[model samples]
Target: MFELKSVSKTFQLPNKDSLQVLQNLSLTVNKGEIFGLIGLSGAGKSTALRTFNLLEKPDSGHVYFQNKEIHGGQIDQLRLVRQKIGMIFQHFNLISNKTVEENVALPLKIAGWKPALIQARVLECLKLVHLENKNHSYPNQLSGGQKQRVAIARAIANHPDLLLADEPTSALDPITKIEILDCLTEINKKFGLTIIIATHEMNIVRRLCDRVAILDQGQIQEILPVARGEIHPQTKLGKMLLEIT
Candidate 1:
């Protein structure tokens, strides 16, 4: 579904220093599969995820979506590409003033959907996230898990083909994290949505990912299959993650 070839990104520090977040990172995400990008805090997992939709333009290399290069394109074309890609973050990026339904409808409205269709789709997405009853609730009124569910609902409201989750469950408690993962799993099965989750949590990877790429210091250390029940990680960081859970 997506591919990154020799992608690299660097940030200019305040004191004239340069921090390379991604160094020649390359990977491919297959359609209908849940892929995991696993690493430590400064491993560039989030930066790499942002490159999927050009949220963080890479300093070098290429990003491809459905076999077409997506970098340096027309603004309209990039906007259209973004519509097909949904993203969720650790902090639920909801408009506190808007109700759950409105928050979910925001993207559809921006995409210029008709009122009737937006209403129907919003309800459908909320129901999928088990938040149908919480439509009238505000973000401040909901718990962390519920808020994340609302974010999920909003993300899928546009019927995106790929979902990018960056530390999605990091802020939640253990039980709530499981709930969110389960919700994502259900979405993947029901819609065959391709998911790329950037997280440091091994439990999340073990429970949800089909394959995982272990990254360290802005580089991809290894990519391993996770669906077969046993994962033999070779890198030091990967081994540590396996031992964590």
Candidate 2:
């Protein structure tokens, strides 16, 4: 469903030097699969995730989503394709003043859905995240876990074909982290949503991802299949990250 080919990215530092974040990175994520990008800090995992939807334009290489080249498309055409992709960040990124339902409905409203349809979809999404009763509550009124759930609801509000979550559970407690991961897993299975998650948590990938790509020094070191069971990382960095987990 998604492909990245020889993707290379470099950012010009404030001092005028350039720092390469990705180098000849290539990956393929199948439809209806939960794919994980495993890496440590500054490993370019987040950068790689952003490239999936063209949020980060690689200095070189191509990104294809459903056979359509993302960077090659017209502005309007690219925008249309983006509507089918949803992203939720480490921070909840909720509107502080908007009610949970309003936040969840924002994407649909922007998509120009009828009021009745928006209301229906909002309620449906809230229920999926078990936030139905928190509809009238604002972000500040909800707990961290609740806020993340609302964010999840908002992200999937438009029934996106793909979901990209960056360090989704990194900020929550262990219990809350489990809850959010469970919700993501449920979302994947229930909607056949193809999910690509960028995280350093080995447990998270083990609990959720069908396959994982371990990255180090801006390059993909190995791609491990998680379906058979618990995987021991073969690469040095992968094993190092796993040791801390």
Candidate 3:
């Protein structure tokens, strides 16, 4: 459902030199698949993910959603396309001033959903993330896991076809991490959401993703399937991940 073709991104420094972040990065994500993008810090994993939402524009090449190119020139088209894609960050970007319900409903409200529809959708989304009873709570009152749940609820409230999760489990305790992973798994299964998760945590990828890609220095080093009986014979990242577990 999503494709990146020879996409590259660079940042200009004050000294006039450029830091190339993404170099001819290309990949495809299909419907009903959890594609894991794993790499060390500064490996361009986050930059590559940002290109999907045009949060970071590619310096060259194209990003296609369902075969349609997404770029800066097509703001209206990009907006409509982005409605089908949702994103969640490592830090739960919740508004401290808004109640949990309000936070989740904000996206729908911005999309111009009617009051009744937004209310119903917000409740439904909270229920999916198992946070239905906390609607009246504020972000300050929630735990790390609860905050992440609220973020997930907000991301999915629009019924997006694709969900981009950038280190969703990074800040949680081990037990909480498992719970959040389970919640994400449930969403993928129940809603057929295509998930592209950028994370350093291999355990989450092993448990959740159908296929995994290891990125290093703005390039994909390997792509492997996640199955107990399947062995990735050639990829260093896959072998390393398997040996660690």
Among these predicted structures, which one has the highest lDDT? Answer: 1
Candidate 1 per-residue C-alpha lDDT over 85-202 given as tens digits, one digit per residue, 9 for 90 to 100:
9999999889999999999999999888999898889999999999899999999999999999999999988989889999999999999999999999999999999999999988
lDDT of 3 by residue, 60-90 (tens): 9999887788887888888877877888999
| TM-score against truth, every candidate | 0.98, 0.97, 0.94
Best by TM-score: 1
Candidate 3 accuracy as lDDT: 0.88
Candidate lDDT (C-alpha), each: 0.93, 0.91, 0.88
Error of 2 at 92 (Å): 1.0
Q: Could you tell me which 10 consecutive residues in candidate 1 have the lowest summed lDDT?
A: 227-236
Worst 10 residues of 3 by lDDT: 228-237
Which pairs clash in model 1? none
Q: In terms of TM-score, how similar is model 1 to the real structure?
A: 0.98
Off by over 4 Å in 1: none
